[model samples]
Target: MLLRIFHVSAASLFWYTAWYDQNFINVPFPNKEYAQYALKGRVTFLTFWCLVLQTIYFTLSVLNDYIGTNADQSKHASLLRTIKDTLFVLAFPVALYVTSAFWGIYAVDKDLIFPDWLAKLVPSWVNHTMHTFILLFIALELVITYRRYPSRAVGYSIVILFNLMYTIWFHCIYYQTGVWVYPIYSVLNWPARVGLQLASTSTALGFYVLGEKLNDFVWTKVHNKMVKSN
Candidate 1:
């Protein structure tokens, strides 16, 4: 019951945020040029993409839980479970990376990652919903669920592929539009950007390993407790 509620609420919140962001009309910015960029390019951001991924994950989770309640042994239920697990391979680490990286950079220099104009344009709750609540929800899910971690090779491959695809995507966007999706990119030279990309990807890989280890540690303790009790 708690799981169902959590999944439902999460799905609803993410959907709402996505819709809000897509349709948002910025208040007058002192810099009309940046306002135009923000309006057009906000959706292209990795944070928005990550939010979409998380929304899909929770929606699937809700469906999976519902089906399990109705027909726990059904083939459809099994398939949903499989899809959920596979999607989590991409979702968890990426969400964690976004939250951590955003704040880490934001702390050092808000202008780089999230500028003052962005703060005035986007409501605090919405910003936190995107960056802060996401981590909290995912962390709660991790505590409640016992996912079988994929082998290191398979898991790392998924994370690497996703990171690489996004790297290519932003570069392509910049090449075409002559605009960096995030403010930080504007300050980076090619070599610095390359270093940043490599570091970001490496950090994501580390988070994947962290998730696997944390999952194992949590469930192993649970298993041991059950064994002792029995």
Candidate 2:
């Protein structure tokens, strides 16, 4: 809807601005002029991804009856799932905001004027690791839900469709503006970028399958143990 459009537009903007200003425009893709959109580009990129993730989760929930299931289950399991889900949902957007804000601050004050302790704590490595973990968690959750309702081919279809659309949208934007929201896309040429996108998407699907298997395995084991104790 309206939110989705805004998110995609914002993420696209942020992504282009970050790349054009940081690296792309002056050197290889010099002909590609995007400075006009650079200021809002980073914000756009972040917002788009946030919306994408939220849409994915919401769609999945509706498809899986999560939104309409029995109230009893909610009373029993809602708290734990809510905490994890909220964190999972918030993690990426927060990271993007922090990164954008930091870059903005740095742009204004060329020198490292922030408190030494705070500056030291926010290492690039840590940020990278955290982002990776959050993305993995998202992939895992998707996989788990997929496993929970494997019989529903429609659910899988929706997931596949969404992922494909996202990939296409990402590549198209990168090509048009010469900016990549994720480093993997930016570092690779077109062929490589396409290959990486396909591989990453497949890997995420694989992780989802693995998560489903693990959940099944664990539940079976726990059930057997309980029966034995009884």
Q: TM-scores for all candidates?
A: 0.84, 0.41
Best candidate (score: TM-score): 1
Model 1 misplaced stretches (Cα beyond 4 Å): 25-40, 69-77, 222-230
Q: lDDT (0-100) at residue 185 of candidate 1?
A: 80
Specify the highest-lDDT model's number: 1
Please list the Cα RMSD from the true structure of every candidate, rounded to 1 decimal place.
4.1, 12.1
Q: For candidate 2, lDDT tens digit of each residue in 5-64?
A: 443443354344334434532212223443334443432344334434544444434333
Ten-residue region with minimum lDDT total, candidate 1: 68-77
Error of 1 at 202 (Å): 0.4
| Candidate 2: worst-modelled 10 consecutive residues by lDDT | 66-75
